[model samples]
Target chain A: MSTSFLHSFQSEWLKTRRSLAAWLVIIGGFFLPFIMLVGRTVYHEKTSAESTSPLFWENLAGQCWQFMALFLLPMGVILATSLITQIEFRNNAWKQVHTTPQHFYTLFWSKLMVIMVMVVQFFILFNIGIYLAGAVPALLLGTVDYPSQPFPFMYMLKTSGRFMLDILPVVGLQYLISLQFKNFFVPLGVGIAMLMLSLVMVEWKYGYIVPYTYSPYNFFELRGSAMSGSKDVNIHWLALSYFAFFTVLSFVLYISKKEKG
Target chain B: MHTIEAIGLTHHFSKEIPVLENIEMRVREGSIYGFLGPNGAGKTTTLRLMLGLLRKQGGEISIFGKPFEKHRTELLSNIGSLIESPTVYGHLTATENLTVWQKAYRCPKNRIPEALRLVGLHGTGIKKAHQFSLGMKQRLGIAAALLHQPSLLVLDEPTNGLDPGGIIEIREMLRNLNREEGVTILISSHLLPEIEKLATDVGIIHRGKMLFQGSLASLLLRQHQASRIAIETSDNAAALQLLAGNGLDPRIEAGCINLAAAEKPAIADINRKLVQHGLDVYRIATVEDDLETIFMNLTNQ
Candidate 1:
């Protein structure tokens, strides 16, 4: 079983080695931080504030990743899930892959694993983007007002680490969506729509039911509820619970469901 | 031993319209079993069910002498299939597409070349699958299916996009695969003439039901039984009246007079009698019933 799982994993990895979507994930990681750098530079050039604070780096790290939880990360998960599985659907390869000696469960889990690894790749590249965008401008201007001080490695790790834990359910949800729909754009459109709805839903008392909002609610609250000022979300328990629940549910349905040629 | 057997197989895409029902099919070992049908005859659906591509609601499929469900993965390792359309990775090159399946089936690396060569697509360099023509794409799909050297090959409309030469090439290859490699093949084709040339055993289906399942000889025998003699002249109506008056039992169909006869001698005698009566016989020939006619008789056509 392990050998079979490995084979499926290798097959998927090889398939996506030069994939455009995988490159998009890498490009997206750099997207937010670089934009932030451009924004801060414009802000400084337009209005050079007299007060210089060391906490500028701290605030930049906090705001960028918080924005990630709110928007970019969720979209990234959706794109990765959709793009990775699009190959199977586009080629109508589900039947071919399923009819092989490897079980669907193994292939299903391997897909989930590939998506997670890609998310991690984004996280690592995102951190690099933040560090360079923060330091490059600061080192040139020699200003303590902008993000110019020592890189906040620990702070960024703790913040993004919370995101990784909190977004597990979104991964599971998107995996199921990609496999269930034959149309390539359905999962992507649904994910984006769900994220938009989750933004509105987060204000309601039952917003915790929406997996898309978990990452934002968790990371902002990672400074603990006393400091961040949100009280209605169950961060770890719901995500982990959703992950475990959907993994089994999707597996059973996926195996029993007829694969389209 | 049979390579594949479907016992009372049935399927439906929707509750209102049944796709296939009570389909009993068997593919014997080491023979090319042609699943003959017209367009939308549920040929692809039945093949999908046998491969476990579709869920079987009310049936049992046994392959390699055991229940397909009980040992699906083990049984699948020996089966190779290309159903409905060609499946090729547009992002990858020709070689890379074969490599992907080669990894999945865990076949030897060298089999890739042999399969590629068999399909007449070797030595094409740096051409991604998206660049391939329709015929090239079909060839690549076949190469991938053969990459693993499967014991049974399930191909649905394998010659849909191929040129005449490519079609004949595939025919000869399938024949060689059956005769030399002893591979059991269950191929589906809507064209009766194409299947007639390649298949040893045939199963005719229409509107999702089995019409006939037997040998090629049996099909030919039915064709022989359907033979008739067509009498043509400048004035078909005159020839028709003449044949009818002479007790030849002629029926006018498609601008000619047709008489039911099992042999050429009867047709000649009719022609000679027509000439003797001063009725012009422009042409007189035995119309041996073709496989297409036999297929049309079996199905709605």
Candidate 2:
């Protein structure tokens, strides 16, 4: 990290400590996987008719991904960005920050960097949570050949890892919207509206190209087949393209934008 | 050296009327310079321009004997500002909020307690700022601004949201900082009397133009020496017409009528003329003008 970026990150990180918004990322990470565990247990209890179910983990994992992709991930990004930036907006601290020695570039990008670090931390904990959510419970129930099958560990890991790549660009978009508005509800409303729009248009042939719907397609369409532990950049190149375009535009606008009353 | 010098500052938002035009202000080092103006008289705009929060379009600003824009980064490290509303992190404790700025300003940790104590909030332990009253918040804002011990403190209406006692506390604190620490303060206020007791130098701005900028002692000399005759009348229009018909220029203000010339002969004579015109002359008194009257005379004109 450059000194300017480091200085900004230090301030950003200090503000995040014990902040409610920053904790939401951890809660969201833990809560989503914990819900999946409950769903799996209920599914396992209802399946006495079949001798054994092959689709037990698959269906549960699929549902978890669908929820994460469509609603939870997008909403998490929205809330996190707004609440994080809202700390500055809440008491009108932007003037002090503006008058500081820190340049707009360092301040803007450093915030993005903090959000990126937070998202990565969330993704890692989420991956570990989901893995334990399935593997630990399955072992206790003697439901399936756990040690013999060794628990599709790589599949769970890859899917969670894929969630990061696909979801990060989503975070970038929310950061742009969140930083522009001092009112938290404006960006939050826009985020929810876009998420709803993404869900409505997910079935269109070219819908995956839409940035909001990209995660749903990537998670749902690719969760089943693309879990082959293969690298495919084309899966989210469009989301990445949008992320890069907006990130640049956001930086330009932020650096050049003169503050006003 | 002038701590802050804004020469020919011209600013406009879009093609609208210029908010500040050709404003040249000078603040001497170690002097509490009051940027005095009525509401919407561009007091806030001029302070923002001085702090480089607003872009300088047509003028040069010098701070600490150097061009402001050129040495902004280095100069900002030596300056602290609270513009309009106080900037505070409400979620954190008072100590924690100061800690956040200590890192930003790279000041030592001991200064946090010193600042809080200076603001009369030293013992409020672990209380988050969200629960603080408005006066406490304003004090905390001042504490945060004072955290780095800047050479020049630029505050825009710092006493706002503070009560009478809180206002005095801040006024005393600013004076102490100026006297003991030699910290130069540039404060903006719409109320002349409020700044009258604090500022060493005063700049009266009205309608984006500076009406007067000089030492407070000099301004006060003009204020105290100003003598005006005020007449309370039953019918102000009749009294004004009577005074005008008698070659006296009497101006009506609020309910009382005032004449620029104040003398015992003038006071006795206006009373007689009003009665001759069948106007009821209530009480007429010759009183010394106050700072508010001086400011009104300077800015209202």
Candidate 3:
């Protein structure tokens, strides 16, 4: 059983690795954050605000979250999810896989594991891109004094960590959507629409319930602001709860539904 | 020990319409059982039900003497199948396709090359399945089915897209597998001639009903009386008159007269009568009972 599961997992990974969409997601992971960092650097260089306070790092992390939620993370999730399901739909490969002695859970989890691994890899690479984009330029040009305190390493780490944690809800939701929808555009469109709606609600006093709104909220200290007052709402917990709930729900649907080859 | 036994098996896609009705089939341990049918004749549905691909609405299916639904993995482990078209990753090469299934089946590493060679696709390594012709793809499909040295191989339309050479090659390969390894095979095809060549035992299905099921000899014997004798004569008018006068109003074809009879003496009598009548008996021969004829006769009734 273990051998069969491992083999299925290996085959699923090989299929993903060979996909053009997987490569695109990986490339976008590196490219998007680099572009953000470069833009921040050029702006900082022009303004001479190089590392003005811990708020600078918080602001940079906010930018990263916004960029990822808008395109990078959703694209990565779609690519990974579609990579697994499309093969079955296109070639009717599930019939062959199901005919083997391997159990259904083995096949299901193998494909699921591949998607999870890809999402994790995208997250790590995106963070690395952000670190390089900001850190390398700061070192090259040196930190400049500004009106507030300088950006600290602890603040940068915390901000990056927060951004990574906030995106989990989107990843989980996209995973569910991709599994359910055969049309590629549906998930992409739905994700973008939800993100945009959350962005719109961010300005309202009650926008803390909007998942993407809280995604960028924790990165910076609102400082007696209305958004800060809603900190007790804890977007991290909401995100994690949503992630766990939907992941289980999607898994149940997958296991319970009679798979048609 | 039968490789497969489905007793009173029934299934339906919708509640009102049953796709398979009280299907009782037994595939002998090591024989090539041809599952004959027309389109939508429940051949695929029967295979699916036996393999536990679909939930059975009635009755039980056992593979190698164990219930299939209750012990699906164990039963499936010893059986390999190609349900419809070849289910292989087009992006992967032939070797990669085999490797994927090999891993899934957890078969011995040594069997991969042997399976490929058995299907006569041994040397086309690294050629992606998309690059293969329909014939190669079908051969690859068979190789995948045979990868685990399965005891029972169930294939549906295994030779659908093959050229004449490919068809002959697969027929020979299947015969070898049955003979050399003693693997039992349950194959389904609409082509009667192909099944007639490969099947030792036969099951004919029409419109979701099992019309006949038995050894080829038994099936042939059952229709032996329905067998016809054809005779060609220089004068068709005189031959028809001679045959009718003897109460053997033969069925007429373009250049021959056909009479349904089991006894050669009756045909010989008709031939001798024709010759004596100066009808010039050109040819007198017995037409062997083929599956097509039996299929037509069975389904028509």
Candidate 4:
């Protein structure tokens, strides 16, 4: 990277420290896993018997993602992206950043890169949480037998990778809208509205066009509960396409905007 | 040499209303240029255009003898500005706020405390900007602007909300920056007295037009022209006619025959002429024009 770009990125990175966006990442990453750990401990008798099944690890992963793919991940993306983009607006600092020596490209992309990196951090934390949730039961309670089936490391990694791709369009669009409006609610409202619309149209044949449905549908398909129509569409490729289109559109609009602040 | 020059700058929000029209401004190197204007007179717009915060609708802006648009990033590296309000992050301390810009300006981190010290914010340790008073926030904003040590400083109403002491502190700081460090400044404010106290040069803008632009001495020269000598005469009507008839412009203002501030010899000549015309010149006194009056006259014109 150029020195200017590196500096811009570093500056943006510092802004996220102790911010609402940072808190959201920490809390959002661990909330569901913490709940699962409690749930498994509360009902160890039923879980210990099911632990011997060959599908034990897969079932546990599926259960963890059911609500996550449906709401938490999508909502987390919306909140995190909006919170990060709104930092400049909240403090009335856009003109300050614009007047600096950095190029517009550096300013725009460095912010987007920070949000993306935070998302990666969230995923890493969530994965660690997931591992602890699965392993802590066997380690602490003698009554609970460790799952006889080998841990599906490759399957888990692949699922996490797919979920990351599946959520990119939501991130791209949220980042775009958040950059345009100063009121935090506008982007947050638009994201929630779009996610709701996608959920409503999930059974429609062309529902794959709505990028927000990609994550949830991917989860349902993996769990064999997907509607037959979803099998015909490659949601991942569509998500990638939508992500690229929105991201480029955002870049053009932002750099060309006359009144940035 | 001119540190900043704007020629024929024009902008309009709609076709019906132009915010700036055919503006011609120049800021000499090492000189403090006070951009004097009232509210909604496009002072902020012109500054925004110069700083590239607003896209120029027409004309050209050049700083340091180069086109602003073509050399924006390079030019901005040597230009520090605070437009309208202080844009400090309320979440960060003064030092951290300066560090943010230091990284962006690619300046050394040690310059942070130096800048804070210059703005008298060096002692604000770990206090978030939101916790600071409005004056303190404004100072932090200036410290951030000064972090890169730009050669030219463009401030739009840097003292808008400052108290008397805060205003004096800013004025002194700016004066020292110009006299000692040689930083050219283009500061905008509607406070005529404030500008009068600190500006080496003044540019009075009103209703989107360049009404006057020159040295403080030249602007004060117009202040003399704007001032009037009021005469209480026995026949004020006759005195008005007598002064106008002698190739002098005089008018009745507040029941007194008023003539533009003139040389001592001219005042004597007027006195003799009025007395010769059978008019008793009861009293002759100079009505000193304040800076606001001069500003009003220029902008109103």
Candidate models: Cα lDDT each:
0.81, 0.79, 0.75, 0.90
- In the range B114-232, model 2's lDDT, one tens digit per residue, is 99999988987978888898888889889988998999999999999999988988999899999999999999998787898899999999998988999999987787567777888
Clashing pairs in 4: none
Put down candidate 2 lDDT per residue, A16-53, tens digits, no spaces: 87787778988988787888667655675543322244
lDDT of 4 by residue, B78-122 (tens): 999998889988888888888889989999989998999888888
Can you write out model 1's per-residue Cα lDDT over B170-254, one digit (the tens) per residue?
A: 9999999999999999999988889889999999999999999999999898888788877788777877887788777888888
- The RMSD of every model to the true structure, in order and in angstroms, is 3.8, 5.4, 4.2, 2.5
Docking class of 4: medium
Tens digits of per-residue lDDT, candidate 3, B2-111, equal: 88998897777878887788888999998999999888999999998787676677998888988887898888888889888888678787887888888778788888
lDDT of 1 by residue, A1-261 (tens): 487777778777777766877888888899988987787666665313422446656666666777787888888888887888777888777777776777767788887788888888888999888776666565556542443356667887887777887788877877887888888788888888988987787767667787777876775575454222136445678888898787778787787676545
TM of chain B vs. native, candidate 4: 0.91
Give me candidate 3's TM-score against the actual structure: 0.84
What overall lDDT, based on C-alpha atoms, would model 1 receive against the true structure?
A: 0.81
Clashes of each: 0, 0, 1, 0
* C-alpha lDDT of candidate 4 relative to the true structure: 0.90
Quote the lDDT for A161 in model 1.
Answer: 77
TM-score of each: 0.87, 0.84, 0.84, 0.93
